[model samples]
Target: MAANAPFTPPLALASLSGEADADWARAGAAYAGAAFLGGIALDADSRAAARELVARDRSEFLPDEPITFIDRELAALGDVPIQPAFNVRSATVEPVAEAARVCRDRDTLLEINAHCRQDELCAVGCGETLLRDRERLATYVERAAETGVTVGAKVRAEVPGVDLPVLARDLEAAGAAFVHVDAMDSEPVIADVADATDLFVIANNGVRDTETVREYVEYGADAVSVGRPSDNPTVLERVRAAVDREFGLEATR
Candidate 1:
């Protein structure tokens, strides 16, 4: 199945009037169209911290439900796709799993991010660094698989010789329902994606336009996640048009 197109309006619900938000999200999502919605995908490190704080505040322990934004977006769009994404890591798996459980209770899927390698993130042993910890990554998927709602592994196109394919295979072997590849690599080697066919393959990153979707298809992505274009309101409608143009999704206009 396809994910939501990117459509991050940069407007926090708490900071807006209900009327203003309804208007903005409607205009933005409608413009972003049928493409997948791009969102902040909670920061993995932030989730760990948020979980700890949430745990402390509760006299009786309850699972963390940091999916406030996802819920908000879904409510705004009604039937449009709004996928949950994040630079989640092995370290954050437990809290992430707990959050995913909460999402599953509501029929939402939790996307596990393994692509971000920001300086602050790498320093914390999250994101790409977790890639080096294969065992940890496997444990995460196998554990989440027990929840029966399916968890996604979002990995960047890296891993040297074998490239993203090997990573996707590793994730699939680990029980991940889908292995997500970030199309950030310009020199994408389509041959490297064959190993992913056994499992669901999703593409994202650097997909700022329609032509990029063609490239992602050429590279063998089963489905793709549109990020920047769908998320940025300035180009949300532009992206929706692009998805209709490129992927051939029916557009209302």
Candidate 2:
């Protein structure tokens, strides 16, 4: 499998799911960096799993309408040339492969969602539950890689007993192009994972400014990602400026 293209600005808009609609995608594309088009559950089974969790907790925002195909859900982004990636969740390889194919056809990146911690998603053996089954997670990555699209896996770093670097290595062995890590509060894990695998590392979590962005890059992240703060143009610009200044790269925005 071919390695995915590197993220342009060394900065990305982390996946935010339901809130990452067409407008959000447009907003992200307007910036001078990579944009991860939120997490989209691959099929009915995956959507149901998310819905069950959302029903129990009204705060969780899942798609109110059903999204049957990954491409169909992402179609609203249209033909924008920005570096766009799609985050997906599934309990089995079939859906992952299917979504990966869509990404391949659309010329985008497909990221496996192994970072979500929803109770219902975990109960159904999806999301962060996949972290517990490294072998299965590898299988999922392998299946997605077969599509010839860039395959990335987004994983949480704080899961108890789960070695983040080891998991990253497993993904590399399975042919993933990059590992998107929600490092939580552990900046060291970013360096560790980068050291453990050859795959590109995109660091997520607690990045509110240039200092944090520079900190992650210093920790060995090929790219640093921002989520909630990306909704604000001013914050996004500040963070983007930091990346530009520290990395000596120009912003596309």
Q: What is the lDDT for 232 in model 2?
A: 85
Candidate 2 per-residue lDDT over residues 1-253, each given as its tens digit: 1134466777788878676655676786756466787677766667788777667653333554433444654676667646778888877679788878888887778889898897777877888999989999999999989889889899998899899889988999999989899999888899999888889998899887888988888888888888888788888888888878777775443
Instruction: Give residue 115's error in model 2 in angstroms.
Output: 0.5
- lDDT of candidate 1 over 1-253, digit per residue (tens): 2243222221111101112222344444445322222222245564453345345552111124435654554455555433333223335567556645654564544556555565444565666766676767777777776787566666665555435666666776766666666656642643366444466566666555567657666666555555534336655545445555655555434
User: Candidate 2 local accuracy as lDDT?
Assistant: 0.79
* Model 1 RMSD, rounded to 1 decimal: 7.9
Candidate 1 stretches with Cα past 4 Å from truth are 1-28, 31-92, 159-162, 248-253
Error of 2 at 56 (Å): 3.6
* Error at 216, model 2, angstroms: 0.3
Residue 62's C-alpha lDDT in candidate 2? 55
